[model samples]
Each structure stands twice: as structure tokens, then as C-alpha cells.
Target: MLRQCTRPIPRWRTVSNVLYARCRTTAPCQPISPVSARTGWVGCLYSTAAASQSQPTTDGHIEILGRLHPTDSATNVSPTIVSKTTRRLHLQRNHPINILKRRIESHFRDYAVMDSMDPVVTVHQNFDSLLFTPDHPGRAATDTYYVNTNTVLRTHTSAHQSDVLKTRKADGYLLTADVYRRDEIDVSHYPVFHQMEGIRTFDKKKIEEEAKVDSETSAIQGAVLSESNPIQPAHTTREAQLVDLHLRHSLEGMVRDLFREEKDLQIRWIEAYFPFTSPSWEMEVFYRGNWLELLGCGVMQQEILDKSGNSDRIGWAFGLGLERIAMVMFDIPDIRLFWSTDDRFISQFSSGQIVKFQPFSKYPACYKDISFWCSETFHDNDFAEVVRDVAGDLAENVELIDQFQHPKTKRTSRCFRINYRSMDRTFTNEEVDRIQDQVRQVTKERLGVELR
Candidate 1:
């Protein structure tokens, strides 16, 4: 049984429906008028080019999510990331990600399901609407995939919160979609992963009326709030408390239901921060002797609600990585496995089932280290992205093992160790050496870092 508490325990337990119309492959390709940033249109454009194995034009533009957008100096989205926009693992039947999505939707039975939204969004929609400040690090090309100066592949599903809330359709909704970020390669991290965003709004009048009759309107009792995580000034203490209670209760119930089959499930809440949410906290579940962070939730920023034309509604929103949860629930050891196409991998599970993943024979790993004089503009993620583009999943992990600053020259040197291994086969030394040679060449040519 899963036990939930506001405070941490020694160890332990714990723990969307929406169908958007997918782009039709059979449809003829046509060029549409260029999208304007000011239109605030949040919809998909289908292109026959998306269905073909076409490459980006020699011109300064690239095709993404079925639309052609001009690329610029800030164009850091690699072909590898662009290719994954169409995978839609969440939409694939009988896949683990899809199965997890279905299980979550079953828990939030009444929330509107919105799985189909364009992966491409305007900068305003992805950042400004979420109240992200101009100087936030996530806005950088190194961290996000920019389609152009004004558009990007969303870094998180929260990008759509304002647009969805503006609809005033469902009081509560669940949105599931693939999100992209430039990140290091590891068993647990990937450039693209699925995320489910959840929001539930309460009518101010209705909640106030309930507070009058209910003695326990404050659902989160004894939880501490600090200067950093203070409730919004616009909300009264009672309002914040009531909404906080509802949010925690709903999430706790969902977690309990998710791990109901496991014994001795333990879960806890810890204070956290996000740009769009105030007084935030993260939920962690004890899985296989580790406390894994499962999701983040908090009261929605009041300004966002105002912008959505729902001034009278107070709400709580949460965004969770489906891959993280699926990894824990299915006992899957590698994140890359979620993208595997092998029959042995895909045939093991069916929709609506939670079966442990069966491990195939393990492959041997090959390691190569490259040392280089560091450039001032060098970013680790950029180096990781380069390796990913060169080696794909065969490059399992890239880690910085040593760093030093030249005492006399005021320069820095760094050494990165890259682990080369294939999920389905062992790598020969000569093949790995060839790949390492290419990595060194590209690292110098692209990053301007001199090889040591």
C-alpha cells in the first residue's frame, strides 16, 4: 500500500484523454502562407514533406512539424531532434508510453483529454505566456529548440496552459504531448520525452460557498510556506489554503491509485520552484530503493489566469514526465528503450496493461576520451548534441571527467569521456575509434575547441 505524508519517512512507498487529429500521411503536400507570430494561432499544419525522408533545404529554412520556418544563427535544433517530432510514442498503440497515458487518463476520468496540439509554438506562447522572464536560461538556443527567432519546439507541456484555459471549456483538463530539450545522453535522459500537463480550476464563488459549510476547507494543514514559496498576494490565505488542499488531495489520490498493486509504497512532498507556479512542491516516490521525483504541481500563477480570461477561477496545475513514471512502473532500465522498434521490445505489452519489461542480453560497452582546450562559449549540452547527431543511440553516455584552468595562459582545458555501445549489438574497437575520430573533428570544427 502507498502511504502519503507531508513529511519524509525513512524510506518507502509511493507512488489524459484527448485525441487531436494526427496529420494525414496520404494528404498531398502544399505550401501555406508563412505563419505570423502575432496571430496567436495554436494549431497544426500538415505537410507531405513531413512524411518523406527529405532533408532541410540549402536555403536558410527548415521544415518542422509540417511547416517551413527560416533558420538563423540561433538555429541549434539538430536533425536528430527534428526527426523525433513525428515519433509520437504517446499515440502509438500498445507502447509503454501510450499505456501509461491511458492509465493516467483513467485516473483523471473527467478531465478533458487534449493529446493533439502542435509541437511547434510561438516564442510568446512558449515563454512570455508562461511568465518566463527575458533572461531565463531556458530561453537560450542551447537549452531550447528554436524553429526561428519567434517559434520553438515546446520545452514542456505547460506551454499550452494559457491557450487551453482560454477556451473555458472544461473546468479541468489533461494534456499529453511530446516535449523537446537539448540535454546530455544517459540511460535516464533523452532529448525528447512525453509530458502530461494537468490543470483543475475551481469557481471562486462555489469554493467560497463550500468553505462556509465545510469546517476543513484547508486541505494542506501543517505544511510550511517560506518567503520564496509564499502564496500569491492576490489570493487570501483561505483561498490559497483551500486550493492547495484540493491540489495535494487530488494528486495524492492519483498516486495511491497508480501504485495500488505494490506493497509498502511510500511518498512525500518537498518544496520546489517553477517560473509559472507559486508556492510549488514536488512529489517523489520511493521506487527500488531510490526516491524518484515524479511530478511538479502548484497553484497556477494568478496573472496567467487573468490572461486566460478566467479571473474568477482559481486553479492548480502540474506537469510530469511520462517517461520517468513509465520507467519506474514498468521496471525499464534504459530510457532509450522506450524508442526501440524491435519486436521483442514492442510486443511485450498491450494497451491498458502494466507488465514489467523483460530484459534482453546486455551488450558490451566501449569508451573513448577526448581532451580539448575549452572555448569561452562552449556549452556542455552543445557538445552532447553534437555527439548525439554523430552517433545517435549508439552514444550511450557523455561525461566530463576532468577540468583545469591554465595558470599562466588563463585558459581552460576539459576532457570528456564518451561511452559507445549499441542497445542491440556489441561495438568493435575499430568502429568506435572511427566514430571517436569523427567526434573529435566535429568538436573542433563546430565548437572551435582545439584538440589536446
Candidate 2:
């Protein structure tokens, strides 16, 4: 009984009796929000006025478009709509784009060695800066990968450190960089990978004074053998002091800054080879006595500075592997995981704190140079081997200085530069000279050349 009453229906609509007569008849051309018009059962409204508005053109014509309507007659249509022809895109399964982004972002968040705040980047885009002459075997067609005719993928990041130091003005920074080379695939070597370089400078006067002292020492020692020597300055035994205490500090500091969470980290240095850094060193972080060679670093060559516009500054620099650091820190076995496009590998890195290398006791290094005359038939590479075998643990490095035909005999004369050092004490001249004598005897016996 309470619901017995029914509402009366309105009369059939006529144009004059419709809402048009009671209110506005004009349509809104302007766009409206789809959300706002849908309250209760009210129909979504279109902006008829906005649609009627003219869009001006530079060429004198005006464009007018019809108002858009929502799919539901009562719904309001938004200006922005998902086009009927458009579809959401799905990423390729093996695409590295997103992986790289996540890896870089997450790795930096977790790896203390990464320095993103620093805008400066160092790269070996070109190989000419390295002392690798055009004719050298390292730059040969078979030895290196040519990215182009003028620029080869740099064989090492050492090639760019000089440029970075000379042009960079940023203070307290880090550089994530890389180089390219042609090498047979192996566990130790890769054709392409990232390299981080740490570079800093000290007073030039100190380096100049050191250079003067080195020159004097070389002059006294007869310039490591005059004619048979390969000393570029020809008479100065001081080429560039790269293997020093600061180098160890740089490496350990960098590692610690990158891996601060580690309970203990041990880094060591051993004598190594490179055309650019004199007295070069190969650094290894200890993994239970199985030292892994990270990268080589040393003092910038004088020629490097001259080429880079800083002819007078002296500095030390180093290159390290980002992947290696990640591997050690994460205890990951395969380096290829870094380059892997798998989501699992990338997801592992998303959110983490970065760590740095910790400081450790650096082994003291003793410096010595010895000169000898040897037969020209003995090449530098061949002679270095003989010296290494004879000198055993005492030998640090042997360099070729000058070579020429003997003025008196069928024999050809050559000069050898040798260095002896110990991690414990300063080597006496007598001790170093004795080792030099042994090197001379070995050279004479092996190559049949008279000592000068």
C-alpha cells in the first residue's frame, strides 16, 4: 500500500517544449573530462564551443574540427584519448636497453667505485695518442681492430688518460670509460669492456726537480748506455716515474671508496709492461693469493702532456674494471653476466648500496738501473727474456736504449737498461751492478756480443 502511487510520464517531446526551450540550445565544442561528466547517471558532456573555435594558420586559413564524443552517448570525452590504431608495445626478450639502464643505475647505487656525479668521461676513442707508431705491430691490421681508417678502437684506456688530465677541470672526480682491442677470446682478455680511470696531479716543481735528479743520475751512470739504448731523451735515465707510492694509494683508495662494506680487501702491485707509463705496474686484488690483474696505471709521459697541451704538469692515473669490481663484490662467477640481457641478472642489481676499496699495506719498492753493451742480433723482446731468467726475482725491468754497428769489429753494439728493486730495502749500487754484470755475461754468452 505504501508503494501504490506511480509517477506520471511526461508528454511526447516537441522541439519547442524540449529542454532547448527551457535553457541553452548551443553545443559545447571544447573538450571535457571523461571522469567529471559521469557522476550518477548524467551523460558525459562534449565542449561544443571549443570545437567551434578556429585554429589560426600562418598562411591565412583557419582550421575547424568537430567535437569528439565519448563512446557512451552519456559519457564526456577527454581531449587526450587512446587512439584506436595505437597499441602498447612489448619489449623484445633479448633487448639490452632496459637491462643496461637498470644495470648502470643499480650498479652505481651499489658499487662505491662508480662516480656518476662527475660529468667527465675518459675513453680510448682513438689509438694515435698512445706511443703506438703507425708502423708498430700493435697497430697492425692483424693486431688491432680498425673502427675506421683514421681511428682504431683504442687498444687500451691508457691512451686517453693524458687527454683527460690535460683538459679536465673537475675536482675530486671519477671516470667510467673503456677501450677496444683485437685479442683471441680467453678468460683473461676481452675485445671490448668498460674501464674506469682515476687521475690526479701534484706540483709541477716537484716533478721537474725529480726529473733533474733523474737526469743527473742518468748522466752519472752514463745514460743507461749511450748508443745501444732506446732512451727517448737519449741520455736521461729518468723517463717517467709511474710506479710509486701514490699509485698504490690511488688504487686502494678507489677500491675502498667503492667497496667500503667489505671486511678486508688486499691489493698488490707487480712490475708490468706498457709503452706509455714508465716503470708500469699491474695491480692485483688478493683473492686468497690468487691475484687477479685488474689494470695497469702509472705516471703520464712527458710526451703525453706535450700532446695534450699541458707540457709541464706531472700526474698519476689508473684504469680499473667495473665488471671485475662488481664480480668481486657480488661473488658472481661469470663476467658475462654483466653483459647478459636476462632480466634475472639485471633485477639482481636494482637496489643496493655501493662500496669502495679499503686501504692496505703497500709493499716498498727499490729502484735501480743498469746499462750493458750487447750484440745487435738480440732483439729487445728476446733479450728481456734472457735477463728475466738470469736475474730471477731480483730483476724488475730491462729496456733497450741504443743500437749501432760497432766502429771496429764485425760485432754490432747495443745498450741495455736494467732495474733491480726489492719490496723490503733500498738496493745498493754494488748489488745492482753485480746483477748488471750477470746480465752482461748472459747477453754475451747467449748472443755472442762484446760488452761496451
Candidate 3:
């Protein structure tokens, strides 16, 4: 019988429940299956729950399991954005998005499906707690959505890592939520997208002993992992090596299990960097003739462990984009389709279903060009956020059709072509006209662009 360390992970908890981690080990060393590793989804990938800025002004809080109080700056977090097409996509039943999420989560059913948190979080939870340096780009207003100088819309589900780690609720968990980022306009880039964070910490000595036992699989697991993932200088060689083996082996099993249906799947690992972890690596899969990065992970930094009240534990964490994987798995051509509210889009998929998304009759895209004299501080991401805020999912593609510099004034002029289209139905000129007008007016006021 094959023997691998089967660590007993804790039950999942909701946001209202106290979060903490406590783990144990099992003796079974049965041959690993693609799904033998325990996994569960904590919540939705895209949250309908991020604190809203334009939520019909209450106490500036939306009454959720936890009240989402307004901070200072907000985007896409407003009730209008939350109530949009995203609410149609979730991890619950009858939703295709959740159906895909559950495929992985089913492997770890005992774990709690933790609900999402208020996107507005303290700067410490978002950055400092993760050991990000003061000058980190993520801390910049240009890259992250801030609720205030001291609070922000979480850029990743990992923003909750410190808090949950401190609670000691479960040694392993999967947190899924809508994360915000300032991004360039593209078919794939949305200011608000979904992400899931998976992390598991282990007792320092148990893992080392598990490795020392020299079990048949231990040597092979150890050798293979050591050849690739290295130990941190700060960690004891033996402990580091054992933890590394567990981390890589566990992740490999997860990837294989995730794509078990594919007979010709390709996967690889490459060294990478992250502020929170040492000896980091990014997992990539060969898909559609290109290598797409699936996730980023590494051994958990000791300081993070110390803060989480697990000073004596050694562990690992990985974060993945749900849309990235789901898109590939379901043969979805457009990132925006996942947010489709059309009955045509929703009717095809069902609860616990795994079906390739079938495309409906396509509508032609109407393009509108807006030329402007731009400010020195003009950012493409800032411009895209405006388009998203004004047009929501109807804004299909935002491309810079042309750009030039006026030599006499030393000013940059830009022309952007906005492709407006409806996935479910054809757009009338009158309908597109109103939206186009709104876009132009909003860009002028919000982006400080002088319409040319």
C-alpha cells in the first residue's frame, strides 16, 4: 500500500464563525488519487457582497452576515455593480460557475464553504500583514481600489489570510471572493474578478518525522521535490525538505485531479517570487498552444506563521484565478460570458453540472471612437475602470485605436475605440447611443480628458 502523510484538516467555517486552524494526521498511506487531497470552497469567486460605495446611503453599511461598512474610496463595490450580472454567478446550486467550483470542492467536502468578506478592509490586512514593503505597487491607489487611505477593496482573497490564520479555525481552507485590481482594458481584464486562496499549515516536527520514516513514497516524493523546489535558508534543512515535498506533491495531485478528464494535459512548475513566501513557484499548464499560469504558491513565510499563532508550524499557500481555469475547462471564449445574465446563457448549465458553454447567435459589435487630450497622469487602467463603472458588462472591448503627441504643446492625444455589444440580444442604435453618450460624459468628468 502506498503511504503518504494524510494530515487531518479542520472543518470549514463561515465568516460569522470564529476562524482558526488545528490539524492532525492519519495513518492511511493509500495510493494517492487525483482527489485524495481534502479540499473545499469557502465562498463565491465573485462576491455580490463587497461593501458598496453607491449603495443607497444607509449607515454606509450593507447588512450582511457581517455589516459591510463604507470606508472612503470605492469602485465596482457599489450595489449597482454587485447587483449586476455577477450576482447570477456564484458557488451555490443552479449556477455554472459554482458547479465548476464544486468539482474541486467536492474533494474536500468536510471543510466549510466560508462566505466572502467585506471588500473594504484595513490596509494592514490587505498589505502590511502580508509583509508587503511600504512602497509595494499593490499599495498604490493607481493599482488597488481603496475605500479610504486606511482601507481598501481586497486585491486578493489572501487579504483575509492573516485574520483566518490567527483564529486557528482550520489548518486548511479555501477562500473565494471578488478581488479588485487596476488593470488595462482587454477581453480578459476586469477591475473586479474572482479568486480563491488555498492554504494549509503543518506542525513542524510531525512533517519532518513523516519524511524521516523513509516510507517507500517518501524517498521518491522527497527526491523529486528537492530537485525542483528548494529549501529556505531560514528553515532547518530536514523540516524544509519535508514540507516542500508535501506542498509540491499535494499541489501536483490537485492539478492532475482537476484535469483528470483531459487525456493530453500538460503541466509544469517554474520558480517565482512573492513577498509573503520563500522558494515560490508558479504553476503553468500548456493550453491552446500557449502556457497559461494557473497559480502562484510557496512555503509560507515564518513571520506569517508567527502572526497567525502558528509560530511552530511550517506550511504553504497558493492562490488561483477561478475565471482563468474555468474558462479553459468549459471552452469559454470570453471572460465576460461568465457574467452573462441572459436566460440563454443561464439555461444551458445546471447544478452540479459540467458542460462546455454553448455559444448563442452572436450580435455585431458597434464601435465608437472618443478622442481626447490626455493628462500626464492619464492611466489606461483608470480609463478602463470608468468604462466598467459606466457601462458594466455591456462594455465588451476597449482598445486604443490610435494615439499621438502634439509637439507644440507637449501633450498626448489618445483615441479609444469602445466596442459595445450584447451577448444575449442585438443592440439598437438608439440603445447604443445612450450608453455611448454616458461613456463620453463620464470619461470627460472622471478621467480629466478634454474631448477632442
What candidate 3 gets wrong by more than 4 Å, as runs, is 1-88, 109-112, 209-230
Q: What is the C-alpha lDDT of each candidate?
A: 0.70, 0.37, 0.60
lDDT of 2 by residue, 1-452 (tens): 00000101010001000000011111321101110000000111213223211112224322112222112211111121111001110011222222222343343342223222211112233335655455544444333433234333344434445556556464222444333332222122223344455555544546444333333322122122223213335113443332244445545555544545545866655444345544455455554334444455555455765777765555555555444444445544332233333344444543333322231232343443434455444445445434444543344444456666657875665665565544234667776666666666655665565555
Question: What TM-score does structure 3 among the candidates reach?
Answer: 0.79
Ranking by lDDT: 1, 3, 2
Error of 2 at 395 (Å): 42
Pick the TM-score winner: 1
lDDT of 3 by residue, 1-452 (tens): 00111211111101100011112222321112111111111112112122213323455543322355454435324443334323524554665557756766776564455545666678898878888788765566666666556776666677788888887777687777766555544455455556666777777768755434334543224523453455666688767666666666766667767877766777676555566766666565665556545666778788888987888778877776666566667666666666655667668778766688788888898888888999899877667766666666677788898999998998999999988776666888887777777777777876779998
Q: What is the TM-score of each candidate against the true structure?
A: 0.85, 0.43, 0.79
- Residue 302 CA displacement from its true place in model 1, Å: 0.8
Error of 3 at 176 (Å): 1.6
- The residue ranges of model 1 lying beyond 4 angstroms of the native Cα positions read 1-57, 209-224
TM-score of 2: 0.43
lDDT of 1 by residue, 367-404 (tens): 99999998788888888877776677777788899999
- Which candidate wins on lDDT? 1
Q: How accurate is candidate 2 locally (lDDT)?
A: 0.37
